[model samples]
Target: MRFKIIFPTGYQVADILNDNIDINVVLENGDVFFGTLFTISNLDYLLAISQEPFFYASDLLIVKDLSKKNIRAAIESLVSGSIELAFTKIRSTWSNESGSDSFDTIIDMC
Candidate 1:
């Protein structure tokens, strides 16, 4: 099933999923950490971390929602700072069948 993501800017998309997803946290020094998704409540997701909190997915950009098939691919692209590529890959794997076709076509063609 597909989930909707409501961004603070009022942007909404139906491609977001509630299951395992990937996110990148970019810090002040430009360092990035890849986290496995845990849950998305309201506008935040609880990510799986190895440190004290044991997990964290706060202050996320909700960048991209991925499916099992493309999660790894998306994370790899995100780590390299390839936002476009990551989203592109994710849209291809997570797009809803009853939703808009624009995204579907783009993913298909890509």
Candidate 2:
């Protein structure tokens, strides 16, 4: 008997994310940062932690089929101390096809 091996779509998504991609982020100081998006898995976005104008880093989740406004709002919510709320909103629209983690590592720096 032969068995068919099937893989989750998240695996594909994660593989794609391994490449460098462009992304934008607005800082708490009303400044915007531009940089590449990369990840081994969809769980973390890996945003920047540098004060340099060109330095960009963030570990955002790769939400599927979301509007630009929604993405902005989600990240902005984080600046407002609403982590779980933002995750909830993003998670509601996610199909779980990507393997990105919802938690953040920013606190680890402190």
The sequence of per-residue lDDT tens digits that candidate 1 reaches over residues 1-110 is 11222122222334445444444333222233434443254233333333355443443333345443344444445545744432322223332336533322222210
TM-scores of the candidates are 0.25, 0.26
C-alpha positional error of residue 41 in candidate 1 after TM-score superposition, expressed in Å:
8.7
Candidate 1 stretches with Cα past 4 Å from truth are 1-16, 20-64, 82-110
Q: Which lDDT values do the candidates have, in the order given? A: 0.35, 0.32
What is candidate 2's local distance difference test score? 0.32
Residue pairs clashing, model 1? 47-57, 49-55
Output the number of the TM-score-best candidate.
2
